[model samples]
Target chain A: MQSDNPTAAILVIGDEILSGRTREGNAHHLAQVLNATGFDLREIRVVSDDQDQIVAAVRALDGSLGGAFDLLFTSGGIGPTHDDITADAVAAAHGTTVVVDAGARALLQARCDRMGLELTPNRLRMARIPVGATLIDNAVSAAPGFSIGQTHVMAGVPEVFRGMVDWLIPKLPGGRPVQSLSVEVRRGESDVAEPLAELAREFSDLSLGSYPFHDERGWGTNLVVRGLDAARVAEAMHAVKQRLAL
Target chain B: MQSDNPTAAILVIGDEILSGRTREGNAHHLAQVLNATGFDLREIRVVSDDQDQIVAAVRALDGSLGGAFDLLFTSGGIGPTHDDITADAVAAAHGTTVVVDAGARALLQARCDRMGLELTPNRLRMARIPVGATLIDNAVSAAPGFSIGQTHVMAGVPEVFRGMVDWLIPKLPGGRPVQSLSVEVRRGESDVAEPLAELAREFSDLSLGSYPFHDERGWGTNLVVRGLDAARVAEAMHAVKQRLAL
Candidate 1:
């Protein structure tokens, strides 16, 4: 499904993530990537690594707000474990089974064989895919996350999970091709809002932003202009900079 | 305000975060922290550096699911800029004018003056607090985050925000003291579920968890037993380890 908003939502699971034991952080990076790609991030939910809860959250994200969003991402719970029931839950939500896909299974099996570890039945569960979904390749790890329809599944390990997201987003069909330029203006955003807003209005396509930072020189706001068109981005930045006289 | 199923939510603001340009990731870390503390993290949101959206998200999280959560955390937007509106929104949610707390102003002024910044009127905005809230100390950064009743506010930077979480959690009246023990058993979770469930039932107070990891040795599941009582946690882990023949 598609919408004018071009929005996305994230579902994060695992008791480790919720319990403070493991500091699992991937949603922020995902949201950042999606935002840069021009996808509006609408909702983010962190559920315990329960099959029913994962299924319910997937359904909810796809129900109404999900319809409003162009993409849905599920992070963590794709590993081979007793608790890792995300694949099963995804299948259950779509009324399918967690079966081994020939491609993912072959790749994982070869990986296991390379290391001389016998592929136990449970280990093979990592090969399971929701029926008819495309596999998202994890270059860092042999166990691949999958994308069945709009839902992009990925691992919980921050490093590996990021590889899957970087792989999946660029391959997708839609995004507003991000454009941005920043200038260091030695003033608070308040000192520059009037002219910046005028420039933002003038360049309707660009999404302008301001960020403050404290460097050795002192505090300054970095004004940025983003859009699909590069020349328009440059033009807006120039106008805003001229207005600030920085 | 305490219960068996504790719930928590977070609101992250800042255009730097929404834009992919800055890998803003503190919010995801906060979600994991709240979860580790046994709060069911219901929602995690990142709004642009815009005030209306910040106000709206804070109000919604404060009122959503029939106020299902015990706390709402807001990070960012408490800086010295027109763009930093988190303090205002928190104040707005409470229908109070955000005033520069005398202590807060004095503290921030001292820090800024020491750093050689002019302490402009805009810079003083960071000192604004919703009336009648206790300030959360920031060990890493002097500008403090605050807690107004159940709503705990924090900074956007990971180091400072995490420090604020540490300061805030220990101060809140104790919930059930969480305890945990784990052992890596060389098998998938499903392969171990039947016996694990029996163990879980035997130790009714403990929350059993299994995490699967792919090491060079092969697939191994980490079995963890958690509970309020340390003795119960030990008992459950002992049973689970014995069942796994570890």
Candidate 2:
């Protein structure tokens, strides 16, 4: 069956994330947003803030392997600092040049002027954009994100990234978002695998997942049924509830 | 200088994670543990539960690309269900076979016996291990994880994964753990990039990072210095503090 959902990939660039100095929250945030917006987030790669690694990841996600997504969202490493190398890496990936976008410069300038902030050369670094890209408005901060081809580059700050996502969602085409129904079962996943697998086979349209988690009491399973067809998903969830006697 | 730290990569396989039904906590937990155990976590990839993709990722992490790590830790997809294909994928990548290990079966049998549970066929599926593999004991759930050819496969359950990691850490050789110190300043990253970069260049042995975050008040930058030598790292942090006038 042909899938109508627009596929997307997320690339999180930072050394702090990889170093375990900071727990990553942006990927989870993006995944939820993409799912709500009807975009199939196929893959997520977290690479250090390195030029070569970022460039290679971008190219590979574009189509290097058998997998290629429609949209690519990259977060982090766009701030005004030496470690923020995402812009140059992205430009190198596209074989394009980085230039100061007039719109971005004006936005930066206006924010600086209003805040009584000096527009130092380092601060102006945020205005640099890859050639032939459109600016993604940052409502929280004046530093603008940019969209080149299918890739959208946004800030790593959750608030700024959220703002850019809210702005970009309406402009892109989306498919029917998948609706989900879940139920908690006290039994372990292995105890219910047979019946669950049978139900999964019965409802070929829906995606059934058995996730095992531990709480203060003991291990339990959460059965989730997801599909574009709400009725089918509901039907599967009902059948699962009956089979598990929940 | 020759580096003594063992490098590692984490591959997370699950549709729930990719679909945003679940937030990933195992990677962060593993990263902290690996760091504390003196291993360098170089890369992390989150792929859907696909057999070919899993096999390909295992191969690539072993040495296929120019980027090769000393160990590859995979979480999830090793369960008692049709979707549990990690064992087969790992065996395929290593040109080996998956068989029910006698020791693993004994472990499962003992747990089942103690819990007054029946050893169902589906539940027994957890005993299957790749050829020439060593079982990493799971103290929480009794389902043993395995290590085959530098690839360690464990359960997705955070509790189980953490238990297996704790069991595995002492068995592996460790290097000197990196020490880190951080200072937060109200100034923006751009305001400190020049001097910070200069300080970074002076301390060749240390890794200097400038992370920008927005709090309720306003934007601020956190300067972190990390190195193997405590004295050197402390020295670098002191210099950074002095350079930024913090």
Candidate 3:
């Protein structure tokens, strides 16, 4: 199912997330957006803001570890605070240096001027971009994200991350969009496991997933079939309904 | 900061999460539980329900990839459906085989009898356990999670996962519980970055993190101090507030 589609991964760098001080939202949002845009999101990893960890994750997700991804979207650690070390870590991973980009600095200066705030040295830290990287526009905040190699570094704040993703996704290459069909049945997953397995074997090219839900009424399963081919996905959905006798 | 605490990682195995069909809650719940239990939650990885991916993540989180962890907790992929291949994957990662444990089968049988459902082969799939693994009790559901070596695998359902965690945390060895103090200031993170960095440098032993938030009112920053020593954490918080004039 993934062989034909371009694969992507997410690297969420934040101690607040790891400490459970903040609930991770950017990864989930990216997952949905990538899925809709025809990218297969293979993995999502959350690591602390530690430089070594961030660098290792960047390399690992960028294909130095094992399986490689076509794109790696990183969230968090792109702010002005001392803990925002994503730019430097990404630069180290790509064997480059962090430098202040003229465009980014101008944008920060303009934002500060508009807000009636000083463009202090601390705020200037947000202008640091990885060498040889293209600036990713952030409409919400002036401090722009950047893309060095296949990795796209974004801010940790949800609004800024969404804005960056919106600005970045349209520029990247996409694959055939996948169509999904879901059938909800109020039955235990075990009761339908055999038939679902048979259907999965029959439709090997499609991704078949069984998600169980429990509510006050009873147990139920949401069987979903996803494929790049719309006709095949529909055919598989019909077969699933028939096989499950729903 | 991590040297004194037992480091733990979470491996979430579910295509639903990666495909954006479901929001990931187990990892966040486990993160808070592990944090409160004094285990340093180092990393969290979300992978699809593919067997190879699950095996790779289990090994990676268990220290075969790069950095090793003291504990690894896995969520999802232990259901009766065909996609539930976590037991087999974990066994393969450990170079073992999945076998139906007698105790687990009995538990499944009792649950089936109570629900007045047939214990078919598909239903019996839930009894499969990794070799040499001890069953982790699941009070919400009949099927039990299991622990092999340092890896403890649990359910994906939030209620079941929480129950299993409640039953499992007390059994694991814990380190000094971390104390965290937060000082919220109605200022942008960049406005306080300099003082925060100074405070962080002064309290090098403690972990200081600045999290920026944006709401309808305006921007605000939460400066958090976390350390094993409660007094040190409090002192760092005080210095952070004083230096920032919060």
Candidate 4:
């Protein structure tokens, strides 16, 4: 039987990241948070803002990943601007139509009225949501993100995106947090690989990785041992140190 | 006739990044450098260190995109460790065999000699290169990266990766560098969406994007205009401001 923990994928939609105009802002944050909350972060994809590309990417992540992940988080392209087409693309991917959801519209209307700004037709675009979806609150900005089925769409701006994630992550089910430890070996990674592979086979329950790093001191390998059980992770790291003579 | 500038994609091969243990280190650096040097970065994908995933990613980017890009740069998995499977995956993707290249072995030997370390078999793992590929020098660390066809492989370490990029970028053919300008509008993106869309249509040749931000002052959108022609870019920005009455 599968564990109760859910898997997740992050789809970053933006031309800025592709053009090197902006460094990634939201995905990393989400990754760290998801790990701490016990959800598995499976994949991250960065695509341009083109509609077809966005729709295709959504379907590929949602459909072809073989239901491996329980939730999909998308950042960027949900704004009111022309380039912000994430909402429509998600709708298209799910074979649904986007409409102005009452909750989203009410949230936007309250925010606009409080700011003494008229809710122009263009501004109202932010209220549009795919039918049969729930609004994800945006504390930083009034424009709410929405979750249609398993896909969640949010703003690209870091602060707003973080807010939405904070608001939504707790509602989802999660497994036990993964425990990990690292052992720094003086020997280079290749020198350790042969034995490391043996250790990996012995510690089948633990996920082991050898990270080769070259710092000012010299090149060395950091052996990382991770598992859902704290005791198993500690035992694996202890065995790694003993086998590698660390 | 098509512009002379080349297009590129960055493949980040690592499990740490996908697992949120480490943030990305090199892709942003490459993106900025590529843009300044006139190459267009079309996409970036972060996949696990699994060989199948690495090979599939390489093929997908190099093959499926209709040769949409001219160069493929990969980082990580070139170390002497068991998880360092990038070199073999790259070779597999190209249907080539990985053999110990004499030049790469010499480079590693010299560095090992200088450092007074034994050239163990594990250490020599770094010398294995795809047949018929040219080695990319790693000034910081002696283990060099390699290039086969249009695919360029480099170390995952930040310093070595940047050094390899600096050495290789100059030799590749490049088009005119793109010019860009930013205009901060004191209005919400939705409020500016209509006119902005019109301005974008008018400046079809230029790539324009509206980025919404929320700071202490309030929510506003930064309009970015970019193009190869400097004069056209300025003209487009001028018309943008004029049309928006900013």
Candidate 5:
């Protein structure tokens, strides 16, 4: 479906996720947030913590090679550890260098002082930012995320990622909020596929999706209609209900 | 760390996931299974149910453009609905055509007869397979998944996807299963970063990662050591614990 909404993609960088040690939550959280803010999320990619992989993914998503997204959000590999290489990878992708941002360093220094912890060089790694980037606020932790080019790099922790997204979404350029409505039918998806396809063709501007689920009540399909226009979304949902004789 | 294990990539095809309507579980499940079965999962990608995107991802993951994986597993978009276009996309990616397989048709026919349901055209869509592909058994449902080239296409349902993986993993070639050990230290990640980096450099064959978490007990780091050799992994973990004084 074509959308006037700005497009976005999420790049999740971590070995813990690739090894199945950590279930991914940041991408899903950002997806919902971006959807509500009316950005068309086109893709979500999970790559290892390897710098080359991170650079390739960031460049690909940022549209350096082809169709580019208006915004790219990355999670993971921004921690105060040896494996935290996102800042360097993102800088490499942008053809820039990583530098210590005074604002980020001050925040880290203040946080260390408040917690009675030494601001060691390892902890200072979090202060590094790509050149020509602005710091993104992190209310939970003082180590701020940063916006470099079209990409916003954030921490992988679920709480910190959510806080970064919450703090950053309001400042982004957004279109009209997307309106989504759904109707649950007890019939099989194939039983309604023909009519649903017809409805989808009729409302080409809206996105209609059929998701199957099985519960104690038995098999069912959730028919969802989403669009930037509230009335159009509601009208399409009503048609779905009527066509299915709900 | 370099290994002899066959590399693999997972492509998740669905708008539901990109829209945040469904939390991704299949990729994580597949990762753990592949890890245990001795496959190196290099990447996991989630793209909307767009034919062009699916074809491009399939080509890229299959290494038609560059470095190829030994196997590519795709989940979702195989249902009996209009949006279920994975089979067609995969066929196009291979420069082939989608045709109904006799074995698949027989399975679907038996399922319909047993369930006392009509074998409608939409239902028959599940029987269509890419030419020159073999069926991957799905114990949960009669609708069989297919493996074309190095790519195995499976259902989106968690139960069915797991069943397909169980049936397919043993049939594929694998190397030594990866051995992983972890030590949870009550110290912050920055406090342990320097020693961990030294250990990582010392044991260049093993992967050492430090993941930080915060709970009621306060902040701590989980030092994970992973490698193909059990002895090496154990040795790395020992070094990490000793270095961190855990």
Candidate 6:
């Protein structure tokens, strides 16, 4: 089905990210992955470990996809800690209970044996999943993530979460191919602002941006040309640099 | 005034971030900032340029604070692009029209002139403020951010956003003093897991975490002790390390 609009959203769950205890780099990493696989990054949110907040965020993001968002990615709060409530919330949002799936339990048990840790009552919480959800393997850690409907829920730990996301995205159906082009210049965004606006209008299919950065030579701009087509981005980038005379 | 529950949330707005073009580190930076300042981070979200999403996110986050949060900080969407709709949505949330406030105008004009940009109709859009709001000055960038009610809106760029958040938060009354202690041992999280959990239970007021990282013996754990009181954290860390015989 060739849909006119294809988008994706990321719901980051945890009190840590919300409180700024951990600076998140996953959103950017996921954004790159989704862009390459062809999904319009529509929205990204960080909600705490509150079940109600997670449910609200998940439901809202799922609804926004309008059946066109090929996928919705959620990161964090899937651990054994008290604050880790994403798994339960995911089940509740889809009107299900947290059940210990057979495969998930097997993975956890193997990891626990390898690590020589007791699989306590709270640790069992890691095996819980929503009904009819498929497990996403976490090679780096014992806990596994899952995908129910179009929502892909994963871990909060950056390396594990990104590992799952990278492995799982390719197996699903990708709707569009994300594309980008960039040219760095030694001029303020405002200096070449007028031409940038015109170029954006000229290449309406491409989303153009003028990012100004400082590197000793006063200020410069990194003009990025993004779109679905490679040729269009290249054309726009060339035009932008020529117009700006950089 | 000191409050019982110091609440906080982050509202990240941008298409670049949502689409995965730009990686967002602001959420994590802000989280660490709030934790160090002793504010309880409740929720964080990244919405796109869509007006409805922004308006809904702000209203919900505003309601969540309920005069309990020390502050609600936001980053991104304070630009002069067509997709920049945060100002308008913020005004909608507050029951006001997006108007050019005098203070905002002066700041905007000064920035535009400093950056050598002509204050055009489009450029002036960055100056549009929700009525009765205070401006957060951007030392790195000319575009000044704003604060309405408790939501502190700043730029999306990590450096600029972090600078603005640092300026805005310390101005408010910080509720709790943060405390932390660390001990690195030549063992994996598994080797010292039991003792760490036992110690965490003993100190109800503190949070103990074991982060496994690179070590000369292959893998090592960085035992972290966090709490509101410095004395308790110190005592707990000392006991935990001794008990584990590390």
> Evaluated with DockQ, which candidate comes out highest?
3
Off by over 4 Å in 6: A1-5, A63-70, A80-83, A108-125, B1-5, B64-70, B107-125, B183-202, B205-223, B242-245
Q: What tens digits encode model 3's per-residue C-alpha lDDT throughout B181-216?
A: 998899899888888888878888989998998888
Better of 1 and 3 by DockQ: 3
Q: Could you tell me the lDDT of residue B139 within candidate 2?
A: 74
TM-score of each: 0.75, 0.96, 0.97, 0.93, 0.97, 0.84
Per-residue lDDT of model 1, residues A202-234, tens digit only: 776667767766556654677877777788788
Clashes of 2: 0
The per-model lDDT (C-alpha) reads: 0.71, 0.86, 0.89, 0.83, 0.89, 0.73
Misplaced by over 4 Å in model 5 are A64-67, B64-67
lDDT of 2 at A101: 84
Q: Which candidate has the highest lDDT of all?
A: 5
| DockQ each | 0.31, 0.78, 0.85, 0.65, 0.80, 0.43
What lDDT is obtained when candidate 5 is compared to the true structure?
A: 0.89
lDDT of 4 by residue, B166-209 (tens): 89989888778878899998877877899888887888877889
Write candidate 6's Cα lDDT for A89-146 as tens digits: 8888877777898888888788779878677656677888888899998557777899
Q: After superposition, how far is residue B227 of candidate 4 from its true place, in Å?
A: 0.7
- The lDDT, on a scale of 0 to 1, for candidate 4 is 0.83
Error of 1 at B212 (Å): 4.3
Query: How would you order the candidates by TM-score, starting with the best?
Result: 5, 3, 2, 4, 6, 1
- How does model 5 score by TM-score? 0.97
Please give the TM-score that candidate 4 achieves against the real structure: 0.93
What's the lDDT for residue B40 in model 4? 78
lDDT digits (tens) for residues B188-217 of candidate 1: 454676687677667766678777665677
Clashes of each: 8, 0, 0, 1, 0, 13
TM-score, model 1 to reference:
0.75
